[model samples]
Target: MTKKLIYNGTVLTMNPDRSVYKPGYVYIEHDTIREVGEWPQDGSKQALLESASWVHDAEGKVIVPGLVNTHTHLFQTFIRGVSDDMPLAQWLRQIIWPSSLAMEAEDFYLAALIGCIENLKSGATYIMDHHYVHTYPENDDGVLRAMEESGIRGCMARGGVDLSYEPKLRETEEEIFANTDKLLDQWDGAASGRIEIAMGPLNLYGCSRAFLEHAAKYSERRQLISHIHVAETSDQIENTKARFGLRNLELLEAVGLLGPKTQVVHGVWLDDGELESIARAKASVVHCPVSNMYLASGVARVPDMLKLGINVALGTDGPGSNNCQDNLEVLKFTACLHKVNQLDSTLLPPMEVLQLATVNGARAMGRERDLGSLEPGKKADVVVVDLRKAHISPVHRASSALVYNANGNDVDTVLVNGQVVVEHGACTLVDEQEIIRRAQARVDRLRAKLAPEYPVFRVVE
Candidate 1:
């Protein structure tokens, strides 16, 4: 087996004790980390390093576990900057829904490729794509193909909305279940287990009670994780209460959807009792601070969630809303947003914010044991940040610099499953420029199609 060694850098283990080793080394054998610690002074270790197939000298760099984006819509990359400064309901109704209907299967593939390229360059190793824009079966296939080609670890939350206000996007209950079952059977554990499939009901506002009940039952029977948007806007809670006489979380609990294997996105408008119920069910919430802020959605009670021992993870939401897939930006925003909102600078420290992006995110995805931290026998998903930049010079504490100072553009090298996918801030697997060109071409066509009815937001380059 091929062995690789990365040495002579600051390694942030991000383990349970949050260890940091100056001028440390990590030994990797194929797809798993063999050892991670300070560089050995002994001759035996020196000899082993000399005999390795590949050695990466990470001098003047910071090595950390790859960031995880627990929730995002890959297909939304096509709709970036489409409907900004609008309310959530209007944005969804006018721009997002119409643009989604106009997209072909090829559009989804190109958009997903662009999203994956952005995520990789941003030091994100895994992405949970909550893709619910599939009007055709081929659209889902296109997304999976892009994930495979991009060589990023992906969780495809195959999504369907049974009660969408947009008629073209809605599906019958039987059709949605059939599509979900077919996708799971075909794609689960595909790409050498690099790809995972999860069940996703669009949301409480858009999916019927019967549909959610069926989704919950299917998830339980198949032991698959269930993901859905919850309490993202005040309208969602109000509409759910109006229809079912229960709040969003209450409706989810009544339909047997709240459990350890469920991940609720947003949760920005949840009350204290709802937070308690989520913590009690052992469920996780993914906080998308930038998206929430960009859309004018109120900040989530992240401090309250963390205080209650609920596993809170970080996400970028979607390219359409957030306009970027950079986890480093998300990390910084999570740290700063909570501090200011709570009126306490000590609320979310650098270490805790780092955890929210890495281990905590892994826990939310139920892959905590293998995917999160840097330890022996864990998957060698690693990112190397070049600290030689002027902005990141004279690193005080590696963790602090990583969260507060270093942006995603500082990411120099990235490895997923011990395979180097990005080097020197360039993707090794896909032609990034070509991907961008194709995505832009699709967007151009979409703008032409949308100009007649909706005023296309022209961005002058």
Candidate 2:
């Protein structure tokens, strides 16, 4: 087997004990980690390191596990900057739905490729794209193909809204379930298990109750994940209560959809009881601080959720809301937003914030054992952030500097499953510049398809 060694860096092992090794080394064989600890001093260890097939000197850098983004609409990358300051409902009515419904397969493919390049540079090796735009039958294939070609671990949570949503985004019963099954047969575990398929119902109000139950059961029998947006805004909660006479999470529980594999996205409006319900069901909540604030969707109860034993992960939501696919930005926003929201400086330190982006996100995708930390026998999904920049010069605490001062541009190298997908701050597998040009061109074309005013919120029912 081929071997590679990376040493002379600050290794942030987000393990159970949260170990940090300065001037450390990690040895990998093939795609699995073999050894990781302090730099070797003894001759035998040094000799063993010299026997590796390849060695990378990560001097003046911080080596950490690749960040996992639990929730994002990657296809929305094409519509970024479409509507910046609009309210959440209006933004969806005007920008997200209109542009998404206009996109074809090629649109999804190019958008996902662009999103992958952005995500890779930001140190995210694993991304869950909550893709539901199904204008064509090949839309899912387009997204998954980009994920495979870009060499990043991804989950296309194929989402749908059968009723009470945009009419064009919905599909017939046979098409929805049959398409899901066909995708499973073709691409569920493709690319050596790097690509995973999950069941994603767009939202509670958008999907019917019976469909939610069926999706939960479908995923449960297969041991797959079920992701959905839950109580993201006050209107969502009010509407669910008005129609079903039950709160969002309560309605989910009544439909037998609350379980450990459920990933609740943008859980901003959940109350105390709903938090308790999520904790009891062992579900994970994906906190998108930047997107929530951008859309004026109030801050999520992240501090309360953590204190109540609910696992929380971080996400950027989508480009339309966040305008970027950088988790480093999300990390800083998550820490700062909570600290100020709770008026406690020590609310979320940089170390815990790193966990929210790394381990907590891994748990949300049900890949805790395979991903999340740098240890022996785990997948070699690693990222190297150069701390030698002028802004990050003389770094005292590596994690603190990474969380507070660093952004996506600080990442110098990234690896997914021992493959160097990004090197020297650019994607290695795809043409970054060409993707940019094509993506911009596609966005311009998509803009032409939308009418000037769109009749003001006619997309939403």
Candidate 3:
């Protein structure tokens, strides 16, 4: 029954009409937004403002719906800067796989904590974490614990690779399904409904056709979302075609995996027919521009996907791949990468890029009715960007400044579920410094344990 009022800010309501209110005020009652409109400066509403339990004066700030990171690997935070400037296959074979094998449940917990803190400070309210490094059952529990403690809302896509390309950390088909069911029983609808469990079969190369069909059917029956990496690299598509005589998307469709609730990450090498099939199925594609460019995975046909009526959302991929958990960076890169790739400056305007992170992301998560926009009756997940910074000063357009000029450090305050989780660019729920310290400690241990087996690559400065 606690009420709060945030007034005197530039509000970007990503509504259907894309309304922007200057000197706006958002009234909140507990976890829901009660009203969003221009601040009543006259004495007529002074009495109503005085009735709120708490009031936040957001002068010289821009308020928008909290940025949504539709896909990420929270457990990969430990592997940041470990394997860079390498192709996806070699990177996984040498550094990532070995490091994952040496990690324990505690390592996963600490890494997820660090990742969640980084995401929160970067104005992200929700993270669809694809945690596939479950060497043990406690590994799954570790990630869930970190998400709950970090106070961020998200879906935990418990991922597993059955047909392992690597030597260790492989589970059988029965074991994968049983573990997934255990996770669903324990974590689905947990964290006061802030965390949801989804089915995450690692990818086509790592999972069998039988496993994919089983995961899709289970996800549909349980009313959960199914997430997987699809056609991210050219090698994957070629290998799938070589093995099944079908492309990745064709295989998925043949197995009945494409649907509204299915989210395919990084559709970089898809064909025209595959794109049409995805749009027809009402499936979503999460474009990780930074990760794709960093891993040299080639650019996704985002414009083509959008033109075909496919729902496209933004993702940071993984901390290991992108080396940062900032959605602002993702937002800016999504806008710029397409324009340069397509050689058209008008493509992917600021408003459209911002929508990919907000409403489109919510649609990918199937929570469009409740989350995404700063509309009344929606959950009060909002971010306040301080525009007084040197880079963001002289703002001509709020949306333009948000996407182009501003970065994650400009995020001053973040509210998830009507509770302030970050204030003045720091997390409020967890000890961020301590999380970083512990995560680094775990990383050190992992590196030492795997050093003899996998030597570090030296770089000349």
Q: What are the RMSD figures for all models against the true structure?
A: 1.3, 2.9, 1.4
Q: What tens digits encode model 1's per-residue C-alpha lDDT throughout 11-118?
A: 999898888889898888999998999875565578657867988889999999988999999989999877678878888888789889989889999999989888
lDDT of 3 at 236: 98
TM-score winner, 1 or 2: 1
> How does candidate 3 score on lDDT?
0.88
Residue pairs clashing, model 2:
none
TM-score computed on alpha carbons, candidate 2:
0.96
Show the lowest summed lDDT stretch of 10 residues, model 1.
Answer: 452-461
Q: Which stretches in model 2 have alpha-carbon errors above 4 Å?
A: 41-44, 451-461
Give candidate 1 regions above 4 Å deviation.
41-44, 457-461
As for TM-score, the candidate ahead, 2 or 3, is: 3
Which pairs clash (backbone N, Cα, C closer than 3 Å) in model 1? none
How far in Å is the alpha carbon of 75 misplaced in model 2? 0.6
Q: What's each prediction's TM-score? A: 0.98, 0.96, 0.97
